[model samples]
Target chain A: MAVPTTRTARRGRPGYDLESLLRIAVKLFNERGYDGTSMEDLSRKLGITKSAIYHHVSSKQELLRLAVGRALDGLFAVVEEARTVPGRAIDQLEFLVRGSVTVLADRLPFVTLLLRVRGNTKVERDALAKRREFDHIVSALVEQAAIDGDIRADIDPATTARLLFGMVNSLVEWYRPRRDDDLHTIADTIATIAFEGIRLPGGE
Target chain B: MAVPTTRTARRGRPGYDLESLLRIAVKLFNERGYDGTSMEDLSRKLGITKSAIYHHVSSKQELLRLAVGRALDGLFAVVEEARTVPGRAIDQLEFLVRGSVTVLADRLPFVTLLLRVRGNTKVERDALAKRREFDHIVSALVEQAAIDGDIRADIDPATTARLLFGMVNSLVEWYRPRRDDDLHTIADTIATIAFEGIRLPGGE
Candidate 1:
């Protein structure tokens, strides 16, 4: 769910904003971990009252949902946008991979936090469900690519999709965004390794 | 870092063993994060007194070290074994990927626990150091393969290694061992996607 930018858009807080609050919460969540971070800790870090945090969001879980949701939404948006690529499934799959790298670079913290969740809470479970949906979409794209004779048919499509995304998703572990231009290079490297690796010999 | 099988193999407890304790510790750590689980939790899970738990290992951190150490040791052993393979670096790289999949499958819980650590504790930092060492070894091998003209020269070897191992390491998330034979199939799939991905056309 899109977190309302403010409790009410017309009456804006002069000093603290909801987006800033969410950003700090996410940073703390990423650093100390979701379970380890408390609202009181957020208050201490943000130099604001817990009452102010509640005024913006209902609970720590809400912050988590918004943070994790941004990542899932970005990925699903890539999926939906990629659906409109007017070409073979393999082309669309490459677009999906490249777009995902951009989203990850753009929303690194959110995606990093999303990757770390283990379905422990309701929020985590919901995030995981969305992730599974995204995985299914990628797997379907791989199968279609195989049927189109664009990629190797020997590997199981689901496994191929998993391994492909495994490499993509792994960027969250080590990649630190040094430049905006680096995203495309990273995307190309991954796509070249993944798609070209799986592609049949003819298109080369 | 080999955990002595028992305090003494000859004088084993009739009901429990260190292996079983480490296994249970790993399960709980995976289920309810290492930081979240307490000594009391372990004692209750094992149906033993906290004193008994202490008698076996110095502290919870020791359990974590032992647990994560198993994964690192298993991986390093694979690294050492792959070194003896006499072939082009590309061939050896494929062997490393396949052997890693086996290690991950055989030591699923330990490897799972290892991936989740964030270096918050000294034990965790040590584990991360070992992981980096493993990654460095793989990257060096990839560099050699690239220099040997077995793989693509356009991509950076370290990034290639990261992406390759990322795909292999991700098996820990969704892959549950069904049959021992499936391990071979899984390993072949990873090697195909990774090595063939970077392979020169015509296999020259």
Candidate 2:
């Protein structure tokens, strides 16, 4: 679990705050990778001592927990919201895909780490389990879409979900937030291409 | 750039022996990560002295260069061959996509590093540049396919290429070799899902 940020009203060093430490750690982690970065590395980047880092958080793993937990929260929220929406299965799938890309674009670093982890640490293992949970929900939606006779039955729903996410996950590699190409546009384009390409039955 | 793996063959305590060391390094690099692993870690894994490692290769960067070069060769080969195939642009795109997946599946470690590198090192930077060249080629093919009116013309080629590779790159996360699932079937299914989706188009 993430360290309780909202409840911690007071701090030993006013300038060195929890939120700021997280921002610094995430940046360094992205630059050097999680395993490459050490507590000393974070302190050096922050212009503080390792003891100062300990003052804000327990260990390096705590930072990972906070970062990945935030990412998991964003994704799970999208899935839960998609489930309650009233529409055809394909329509719901479209909403889910669009929502996912937007979230990814917004929280790019956390999502990038979430996508890249190899289950080497407990935090990584937790992120993976949460990811599988998200996949399970999407698989169900794909199945429902197929049953609605909107998508083809030839392929399995599990396979379809993986393909859908494969496209979505690729965003971490190249997606840069631009003035012209914003998150909304990227999400809409991804959904349109995915839905148009896979909607069931041949084209007119 | 690689110290010419073959050229160093004559020197005993063999400079060429570095090739075997490089292979061992790349294998470890893929499993643990370049940042996560160390020279000492590599020496331990290879059952060789740290001095022995230096005899063949100068530094970790050389090993990265050799590994990424292998991946770039595989991908560029696909683009070069697809350009010569006798077919419409869409057919060529399909062939390229299928071939890219197969190549990635075959060279999982190299491509996995290619996909995972964040451009933090010179080796990663070079790999990213080569990857961009490959992307440019695929985007051109997507543009040609759109011009031929074989596929939908509404989506931009850049976007199409991202989605295409999204499906292909997702292979590293889940694909396993020597497994029960037929790769031929997997490749065909991806093509089907890409060209014609689960939903049959309106006309045919």
Candidate 3:
């Protein structure tokens, strides 16, 4: 593969392009898992020396940070955009959940790794901290919805938020994007089941 | 610690009791995570040599197998009992969901480890296979419930099962056994929200 003009010489040519390196890293991370992946393994996969990888990124943890940050940035952006939307609390929550699912589906590998990382490394820990902040934002929305009588008040907001994300996070586990499974359809299905629920609201 | 056994070891001593070793192993597995833990770490934690651990179990993978098998057994039993219960499909599913939550809270550490494993080892692979089987069974139940016209037909059964288990699995992420947070109470809350949902029935 040809190195793009953006690359700089660091003693020698960058052994692998940055874009190729990231795609390979994400694939390996998904395959062997984040903790199971090693620098040597990544080098072997990319047909590049370990030094070549170091020239591109400092370490394996740096790769993880780059990958999970992609997912986290997508999620936090959804929360930020949804909060500004003019609607009822439930409507805002609906927009947030649907948009989040679409992001998760689009960035499946990155978000899958993000969800699985248990803070074993600094990168993983930072990802988790940011993840908790996102959860807090969603939980606050659930709290507002509950207070507005848009949602049931019997359950605590934190528990409700956990349940909501639980439903959303499971998307990473089972959502295989088919040629037919468009984001709009997937997001609509998730939102409908989430808001109105699997029970027919009118008479069931 | 004094060796309580009446029989003396032919070697230096009976290094560590099996029960005590298991307790320490489970604790370490929970703390460092299963993939991150090593035999050397386990030995140091037990204050015993690596060879001494081998005297009880062949390998670290054996300990993982034992730990995950205990959790898998609990989950499979819940599904089996649910299958035999005489009721409509939704009722049986409700029973299974509550039972699984109770088992999960009861065996929090083991199930937490089981949930986190990424098929990096043979033991992990086996655990993942069993987990998939359990998911399949639950999906079948979800389908049956939908067919019976209990759950709405619009949402796919597989998706609903994922949503249901997602709610159950999130318990491990945050749930702590507090004085106020009883297991049955939490299980009841999960089932209620899962089935009836957070929406007030009949618009209150």
Candidate 4:
């Protein structure tokens, strides 16, 4: 795979690093469904030959595995960190929520790809398995929180966890990062709404 | 375009009515994206000739148009009903949340298709525009509710509205309908989480 001299790297991505290559691959996979996108498509988009792409990543499946791995890694890191928080399950849950919003925001493309995985192949199936594991951890937290009288016991903990993360996971869809947007404020709002409720005290 | 006598509609879809055809088409579009799905594929799945399938809907784009229309119309209908609720803005917002959930659950496939549109074509662009209009209406309700001192005014209303609906919209991804699952219980859970929140009263 002869490295193209000039025209291929017109986007200033000439001599692409693995990180840059992975980012572009994830973006393409998200825009075009994993099944819909082809190796030729990725090569063309990257302005490199197919062999050049294969040099960095063994296969398209490897590309997907790497991208979703980055996202899952970010999420699990938060879960691991929250596990050490010194408080009740509610406290850990809040920490997870804040940490997750930061992960989704920081690694939006990778997380977006992770969220869209549909288990079409071995790589996707692994990602889905990891995701279920993550969900189980969250549900356990919610269940423990409910038992401690910290969270509402009226709702099933599993259902409660789904809705809680549903709101936070939604950032990939509509949350465009703006210059002035505050990540802490965003996390604060999620915690506020999730814990304190959005309706004024007397109004509810 | 004479219809074949036998094996085409192996799924018991022989002689598909427009409703049945629309449902199957939406399902296929969801499974294999609209661009990836061919009319021949639909005809093969329906046990009809391509021309016979075309006799019902003018084009695949029409199928997409109709599919997304069903989903958008369901959402708009909820908005209209919410408008008729003679109460505070918070009340209307709650109504919108519940109604939207019903729409999503009842028409899961259509709503799923609606959420995945990426504005690649005229039909998609139109659907995206309608979606924005729907978001604006919901944001207005949130803003008004905040001004009324019913909703906490600290967070931006638009941001709040996005997160609220994000939770509802997520039903398409994970929510599976079972005969024993009560719809009201689900709606109550969403309303409770969005308005009253998940934490116990004194937990904060």
Candidate 5:
């Protein structure tokens, strides 16, 4: 029943463009994994031929590059956005943290694929390098935040940054956006829990 | 270069037991991913024949089962150990958090595989089921702790548990056993940062 509905929906669609093709490809990649997936799998999933998939993207690696690149672009943009401009380093860090949750929520599947890439291919290796760069940028913010005495000073800034973002990144594991609890609510919850430990003010 | 050293090291040893084989398999699984790895790959990496590999473990799935089962056993043992016995719910929660980090560090590869399994196979599904059970137990502790006024009440206990473990679990991503920093040190840092927000006690 659902399969027929999906088939009919795709049939009703006018044409497959690069964006739409990439979306379908990413879904397959995430489901079966990048290595496990092939152009034949994408074609089968999309109810199209291998040539149709190639017409949009030269190779499976090209689809992976585009998909993960979309996620990476969103993340790097968050760091550069005027709103994320440096105020206090801690404030900037908080903005990045919150902005990241929003990005993860908005581009969940793409970011999920981005996080799971194992550096098995050139495209994957590039994605991992970019990810490390992002982490380094955030870690620097953490160092500045500690130096400014905005956050705790005892823990190493690099470790602090990784753990903080780890809490944020874990969202990709289970966070599902719903109508009642929107992305903002999820992001705010994460920011609060991360910065303000789960303890109430004045509680021991 | 390293391959001969590994083979020589293994051959110098007398007993080739199940535990040792699982460790090698888990390392391969983590490196190439479970689905991406094959028995031939394991044999090549180990410098052993397929028959020799099968002599220890009947199949790759059996190896995966034993590897993940070892990790799950370690974790479950932490929960059941007299040291983690009933106490202030908050204290119990703290013990579990710290113990989990130790387990992660001690059984890094196996736990890494456990965490990454996507329930694609029967062995993977079983591992995921046990993982959910462990999460449920920890979440219950969080709930009890919140009820006892030990932790904050704003966020759901289950979500708090996930995020807390998320921070701990992220250790597998970058943590390497170093001479200066030991597992206890890593565990202590995670506990302090987690329970006491990175912000100093008096700071905003």
Candidate 6:
């Protein structure tokens, strides 16, 4: 499967490459659910033959794998990138929260699908395992932050991490990229609300 | 259908009632997608015939309606109870948060199913509408809190309400009723993290 470089081809028919096809597939999966969607549905939605879709991805499961893999890859990459440079544990944790929101916003459809996977099949189970690994890495960062005295020491680190990410993860349910609201503003608001509580300075 | 007042009946087969039947149905619905579960599946799991199941709820949609309605009723009651006495907006907001977490903990299965509804059927669409209403009421409280200068003024109240509830709502995904962790502590942790942020007092 080749990445789509151009939006259109010389032919009048709508031209779609692997990436474009997967985007549509992920959107459909999110709307109709993975189990409810079929290759025929994808074909009909794309206005292309199933053979054309098969030419890119082997099967429906492959599309599911590719879609969720995109989300997981982005998350793991954030942790990997954070590892190369040195910083305080709290700073690293902040970076992760910011980067995760960016990834979530950038790949909203894919991340939404990834989060909704129910582990009904082998492919879904694999995705769930990868998700757990990502969660573990984040949990460690929370522990280190607490140990470094960067965050409150009262709450358990694992539980703190879960609540923090839970807030961020809920973006998929209601967040829509607005023309006026950029991703950075959204990310900053999340960070502020998560780190500072929403209380006015010296008010609470 | 009559609500079960007694936990046990005189029948030798360990008689079940409507509330108990709905509990089992909700668990099954959560495990298997609501659309995927059928009366036969519920009967098989309950060790009863479909006819016996019909003695309670008329159909699967009724089961879903009853389950989600349970969650909605709890939320509405909280808001209704709050209106009886006058208090500061922030206090009202806090009360809503605390009450919501308690409700979520007490009715985890029902709320979990409520949150996961995708509006595929009329029952689901109705559930979604009720959820939106709940969000609106919370958002109003948040707006009032910001106006009262109890919370930060920089962020939009609607956005703050969404993220705050998002953090609280995520509890259904990971929180289990445990011997050591009491509901008040869990609710306090949520309220503290949300209103106070998790950072150290003097630390950023």
* Candidate with maximal TM-score: 4
Better of 1 and 3 by TM-score: 1
> lDDT (CA) for every model shown?
0.82, 0.78, 0.78, 0.88, 0.81, 0.84
Once fitted onto the true fold, the runs of candidate 4 whose alpha carbons sit more than 4 angstroms away are: A1-13, B1-13
Off by over 4 Å in 2: A1-14, A198-204, B1-20, B201-204
Q: What global local distance difference test value does model 6 have?
A: 0.84
TM-score of 4: 0.93
Every model's TM-score: 0.88, 0.87, 0.84, 0.93, 0.87, 0.87
What lDDT tens digits, residue by residue, belong to model 4 across residues B1-204?
Answer: 454534543445457789999999999999988888989898878777776777788889999999999999999999999999988898889999999999999999999999999999999999999999998999999999888989898998777888888889989888889645577888898899888888887775
- For candidate 3, the TM-score is 0.84
lDDT of 6 by residue, B82-188 (tens): 76647788888888999989889899999999999999899999999999898898889888888888988888777778888888898887888974666777787
Report clash pairs, candidate 4.
B8-B47
Candidate 6: misplaced stretches above 4 Å? A1-16, A43-52, A84-86, A178-180, B1-16, B47-51, B84-86, B178-182
DockQ (Cα-based) for each candidate: 0.33, 0.41, 0.35, 0.70, 0.45, 0.56
Off by over 4 Å in 1: A1-14, A179-181, A198-204, B1-14, B178-181, B198-204
Q: Model 1, A204: alpha-carbon shift in Å?
A: 18
Q: Write the per-residue lDDT of candidate 3 for residues B1-204, one digit (tens) a residue.
A: 122323322255546777678767988887777766888898777666676777788888888888888789999899889988888888788889999998898888888888878787788998999998988889888888888888877776766787789889888878887746777767766776677666554332
Candidate 6 TM-score versus the reference? 0.87
Candidate 6 residue-wise lDDT, A1-204, digit = tens? 332323242236686899999999999999878987889888789877677787788899999999999999898888887776577888888888999998998889999999899899999999999988878888898788788888888877767787788888998998888746667877888899888888877555
Q: Which of the CAPRI classes, incorrect, acceptable, medium or high, describes model 4?
A: medium
Please tell me how candidate 2 rates in CAPRI terms. acceptable
Model 3 interface DockQ: 0.35
Best lDDT among the predictions, by candidate number: 4
Q: Which parts of model 5 have CA positions greater than 4 angstroms off?
A: A1-14, A82-86, A178-181, A200-204, B1-15, B82-86, B178-181, B201-204
Give the clashing pairs for model 6: A197-B197
Question: Interface RMSD for each candidate model?
Answer: 6.3, 4.3, 3.3, 1.3, 2.0, 1.6
lDDT of residue A122 for candidate 3? 82
- Any residue pairs clashing in model 3, and if so which? none
Show pairs that collide, candidate 1.
none
Q: On residues A1-204, what C-alpha lDDT tens digit does candidate 1 reach at each position?
A: 233334343344345788888888899888877988888898778765677677888898999999998999899999989999999788788889899998988999999999889887999999999988889988999888877777777888788888888999999888988744377778888988885662224321
